[model samples]
Target: MFKILIIEDDLKMREIILENIHRWGFDGLYVKDFNQVFNEFINYEPHLILLDINLPSYDGFYWCGKIREVSKVPIIFISSRNSNMDIVMAINMGGDDFVQKPFSLEVLMAKINALLRRTYDYMSTEANVIEHRNLILNLKDSTVSYNDKKVELTKNEFKILYVLMKDKGSIISRDSIMRSLWEDENFVDDNTLTVNINRLRKKLEDLDIENYIQTKKGQGYIII
Candidate 1:
């Protein structure tokens, strides 16, 4: 099933949209951390995003630009403001489409389905790769390549790199990585994550990529 992320702040609207999304046979994800919108997007890896222009911390445009920097995930701007400039700005900010607020569920679903069809149908088989600064991580082969040099990654290393690159501009905590590695962080070894990270870094260094991953000193790691 395709995952659809709802970044709407209005509680009632979010719930309604989520309910309809599930009813339409799509996996729906809602954000719990408003400040970590990109992190949630990376973790969920949604096929499409439904973003609201008016948000609590940062507006949808800012988050849209952040997501565009990492992935080409489809984004639809949903907002009450429907001026010509708002619509234009949404499209210019890498949004695929715009849906005005107080919209009918049927209309929204139609737009989403059409967008998804157009997006996935024309995509190539190799399009599953996630890229960051010329470093390509192939989702199909589980390999990372940079400048004609490639390295294979362990399952844990791939997961760590995927999460880090997904939230490139933000710090991802060790606790979060632990939770991603295991269902419960408490069961994970304290040094296991550190060891995996070091191995991943070494592999990258082999490709002449140095300090790509930055340590935030007690915070966690970030790709910058």
Candidate 2:
């Protein structure tokens, strides 16, 4: 089953969208905090995103751009704004489709299924695999299974791992980590990154991951 991520701030709309996801026969995620869009997006690893434009601090376009920076998962803009410019802007910012607000729940679910089918249905039955030592990261399925046992990772942990794995054996600076993981937040300090990294390290350790994600004395971390 395909997973959906809803980024809308409206409580009723979000619940409706989530409740109707089962109606579309799809399993997915609904975000808890507008401020933590990136966090939820990375952690859930949903195949598609349902985003709203008028958000709490930053708008949908901004969050869409942020998501595009790391992942190519599909994004659909769902908002009250029906202006041509808004629609055009949404597409330009990397949204796959636009669903104007006050939409029918049935139609919304249909659009979601259509998009998922088009993007993933016939593409490949295989999951994307990236490895370092014994650890395996499946990009397509957004899963990091260890030694054939699925090791669960939060969005932050996965994103951090993705960035690190992409630059394996290289020193990825703390600033860089902050930039990638903290893009969606209004303000993220070093403490937040530290906490996230620490938690990720614990998870990796539990998986018996083999790597040297070394903290280079105020420089950064390197998965060597």
Candidate 3:
């Protein structure tokens, strides 16, 4: 199943698009936090993206450029704005196509199918991988590896590592980590996050990476 990432901020519209996508036999993932769009995108490694123009903090055009920096994954801009300038800017910012709002689910599916065919047919399925200090985090496979050693990680472990390494030098607060893990505000206790971090740390230790994840007293965690 091809994975499609939806970046629309409107909850109702996002749900509508996701429901249609599932009915059409495609996997759909929605962005939970607008501020972490790029990080979520990298973690999901979707085959295509459905982005909107109006968003919180930063607009879709900004995110389109950010996604372009890392991957050539197909991006289709979906927004209510249909002005010529908006259309032209979308294309210039590395968007594969643009679909105005009030679009039919049928048409959206057709566009998605065409893009997937054109992009993936005979194209290399390159693993979505990120590296920091010689430790490779393969997002596609949910594994981490170092020289002559490899370790598989659970979903939580992979997500925690992704956030830490993606930022690398900066300290990520505990609240931020929990939000990344459970965006719905579900009750994931403080101990849960600590346990997950400890487990992840041990895995790194197994790969001969000692103190790879450091704790910032009274702040949070950092990987430098």
Candidate 4:
């Protein structure tokens, strides 16, 4: 089932949209921490988003632009602000649709279904980048970016970072990481892996992102 993320701050409206989302057979996810809206969007990797214009900390437009930088996932703006400018800005900010407040649940569901169909029928839903903290690793270009500075990665560096970031908090053994590289046809032993790890760390350090990949002593590595 397609997952829909609800970014509304109003509890009552959020609950209503979430309930109707599930009722229509789509998986519904929601944000409780308004400050972590962008983080939640990365973590959930939802197929589509229902975002409210007014929110605490930052408004929907800010978050929408941030998300647009990483993925083209469909976003629908739901807000009480029905101004022509608000609607136009929503579209300009990468929102796929705009639904004013007090919208019909049936109409909203229809729009959601149509957008999902049109978006995914001929396209892949997998995100091309993985984000942790403020770091974004672009799988398409084998590049790691922090702040606005980007560093190109070698095939080995990209593979290693991809393995660790894909399972951010988990302790991946050296054997496991080496096996992942092996699967990609880049065979390497323990010493070679260590060199690659140090090189990757140095690149991250250049970006001022220190200690991003932590060594777990007896264990292999982890990104937390």
Candidate 5:
């Protein structure tokens, strides 16, 4: 089943959209914190997104730009304002389609299914390979390894390690890690990050890497 993400601010609208998603036997996630939309997006890993224009803290345009930086997921604009400027901006901002307010739910789902089929049905796959230090990240399967031994991790652990390894020698704050894993089933908190990191450290120790991850008090973490 295709997973859909709703990035609307209106609680009622989000609720109705989610209902349609369930009716179609698909997984759907609603964004609760506008400030951390990207984190939620990655964790949910939706096939497509329904993004509204006006939002708290920042507009949908800002968030759309951020998502584009990391993913090529399909986006549809659901806005009340049908101004020419709005439609132009939505298309220019990477939206696959725009649905004016008061749109029929049936039409919305049709657009969604059509987009998903077009994007994923015959799309080429990209490998997810990342390397740093003695660690190699296998993007294809979300696996990590040092030398010839593989490191098995929970989903959160893999994400934490991936982010850290991607920026090796740079300090990554707890807040940053939280953002990367926030879309996970269990909302990631600061303490949860610490626990996951420690677990990863223990696993690494078995492979002869002692204290590989450096901790900076009141700042962040780094793998030196």
Candidate 6:
């Protein structure tokens, strides 16, 4: 079953859309925390997204750009705004399609099905990228890029970053990080882990990103 994430803020409209989506035989998911939309996107891994323009904190356009930094998942903008500029901006900002508000559910579902078929039919694989605070980590290449400048990471550095960034808001313990390195056959002791972390921090600082990783005394490390 393909999962569809609905990012609409209107209570009635969001519920209606979700009900219709389930009626059409697709798994429907909605965002409970608007501030954590990106995090929910990562957790849900939806096949497609239905996004609204006006939202609580940052608008849909900002979230769309953030998601585009990581994945090419199909996005369809749903809004009451019908100006040509709005539609143009939606597409320009990486949205696959647009649906004006007070639209027929049938039309919306039709567009959804068409986009799903067009996008997933020919695409074989998805890019493995993680983005936080405008910093992008490309897992395939073991490199980190910030503000257009890129830096290569050693195997240990890449693994450590990956583990932390994968769970960005949570603190990862020293022992847990060592186990991750051990699983990768890196054989890292406490001192070695500390050395790798310092090196990674230096590289991030070189990219003008200070305090990208934070140390929590008596606990562990976290990227926030």
Overall lDDT per candidate, in order of appearance: 0.87, 0.79, 0.89, 0.88, 0.82, 0.89
Write out the backbone clash pairs for model 6: none
- Per-residue lDDT tens digits of candidate 2, residues 69-152? 999999989999999999999999999999887888757766765677678843266347778776788776566767766776
What TM-score would you give candidate 5 relative to the actual structure?
Answer: 0.55
Per-residue accuracy of model 4 over 38-136 as CA lDDT, tens digit each: 899999999999999999999999999999999999999999999999999999999999999889987787688778777885114548898999999
Error of 4 at 149 (Å): 61
- The C-alpha stretches of model 1 lying farther than 4 A from their native spots are 122-224
Q: Which pairs of residues clash in candidate 3, taking residues 3 or more apart in a chain or in different chains? A: none
Residue 134 displacement in candidate 1 (angstroms): 44
Question: Taking the tens digit of each residue's C-alpha lDDT, what string does model 6 give over 75-152?
Answer: 999999999999999999999999998899867877887788777742136357889999999978889999979999
Candidate 3 per-residue C-alpha lDDT over 1-224 given as tens digits, one digit per residue, 9 for 90 to 100: 58999999899999999998886557999998999999999899999999999999999999999999989999999999999999999999999999998998767877887788778852145448989899999977899999989999998898899889888999988867865565222445689999999999999999999999999988999999
Which stretches of candidate 2 lie above 4 Å from their native place? 126-224
Backbone steric clashes in candidate 3, count: 0
In model 4, state the lDDT of residue 58.
94
Q: Which clashing pairs does model 2 show?
A: 42-155, 43-155
TM-score of each: 0.55, 0.55, 0.55, 0.55, 0.55, 0.54
Q: Which stretches of candidate 4 lie over 4 Å from their true place?
A: 122-224
Off by over 4 Å in 5: 122-224
lDDT tens digits, residues 16-111, model 1?
Answer: 999999876689988867999999998899999999999988999999999999999999999999999999999999999999988998788778
Q: By the lDDT metric, which is better: model 2 or model 4?
A: 4
Could you tell me how far off, in angstroms, the CA of residue 115 lies in candidate 5 after the best superposition?
Answer: 0.7
